[model samples]
Target: MTTTSGFLLDQVMVTRGETRLLDTITAHLPGGHCTAVVGPSGAGKSTLLRLLNRLDDPSSGRILLDGIPITELDVLDLRRRVGLVAQQPVLLTDRVAEDLRVGRSELGDHGIRELLQRVGLPVEFVQRRTSELSGGEAQRVCLARALAVEPEVLLLDEPTSALDGVSSGVIVEAARDHVAAGGTVVLVSHDLAVVRGIADTVLVLDHGHLIAHGHPDEIDYLEAGR
Candidate 1:
């Protein structure tokens, strides 16, 4: 994983017709740290996460990655460096090892097994059929796949939203380990427990507006009914 001064969003806004999904969201998410984005449903959380990896370009504004505007970089190269694990895990291949090697072809069985362990999967899972694993296991494999390239940043969109506590814990541990090892993580989560547990900084959004940016305790999830 590569670490550098991270994302800078300048007056970013996203709109579709008359509706704004994000209203001038500006903030600097430091490298090698975990930043959690929290908001109620319909508050533009997913839309915000998509822009980080150019899954969707911002309607208007500048997003800089490692001091260069992301728009100026090749889309594929940028995505390679900024890997994303969406809420749902969609295994690209039928086999686990093949799915993990999608980004780096030279990744061997040993490397694939190591990645699986890192995400809390048994090494034996290296040869398991994707369709045979449970939801939690598939999600972990998806996370390992993202980590396989050793990306500069991990853009996780509600990764643990649908998992059980045990599964969620594994994912949270993986994110923390990534940051501890100097990789950046940007997470969008509605589960307040997740935000408080792993977030070094929290960004609160409401109705397309950035309402708060500070430590996790700064945002009162109770009062906001998050």
Candidate 2:
């Protein structure tokens, strides 16, 4: 399949003051497909997601979004198109409704309700304070907020890491629905089961290097040690 809106990383490298975070990574993230980035801790899976969304620039090489260098695109516009839901949900205000409204004033009450339902939340929760939400609920709210923006690419960084099995399943369904609607999803996860359930393609990272990229079955052996 041709990916007109896919991401291309060419010799991408990220370095901190003294350490290399990611090294010479090259890969293609096809559009309309769910690509999972998996590896042990400190393997730069999250770092790769940040680079894809331009949260930070690479130390060397280029990242292309739909064949256009990301540096050439407007920062705010790029972020809007590529929404990220971090491991921890960061709410802008106390009210769940207010948090969803951030960066998306165009969303009406009906829109907010739909988004909440899409992430398996009840419409009544919109008026509830963030303080009242459990860890899983908060994460789902964050996912709803990200979807509110209608992003072309959704980057999920271990979205269900802190949640229970049922909560994790809800998040997985939300992501699958997004991809089914022609959205591209890049998932950073350590849960092999979750990756196997949703990933169409998998990218394995180790010590900031791209170790492998193939179908889920091709990398299933990575689960042996865990």
Which candidate has the top score in TM-score? Answer: 2
For candidate 1, lDDT tens digit of each residue in 34-139?
9988888889988988898899999889999888899999999988889999888899999999999999999999999889888888999988999998887888
Candidate 2, superposed: residue stretches over 4 Å from native: 220-225
The list of candidate 1 runs beyond 4 A from truth reads: 1-4, 222-225
lDDT of candidate 1?
0.88
Evaluated at residue 79, the lDDT of candidate 1 is: 87
Per-model TM-score versus the true fold: 0.94, 0.96
Clashing pairs in 1: none
Worst 10 residues of 1 by lDDT: 217-226
lDDT of 2: 0.90
Error of 1 at 34 (Å): 0.3
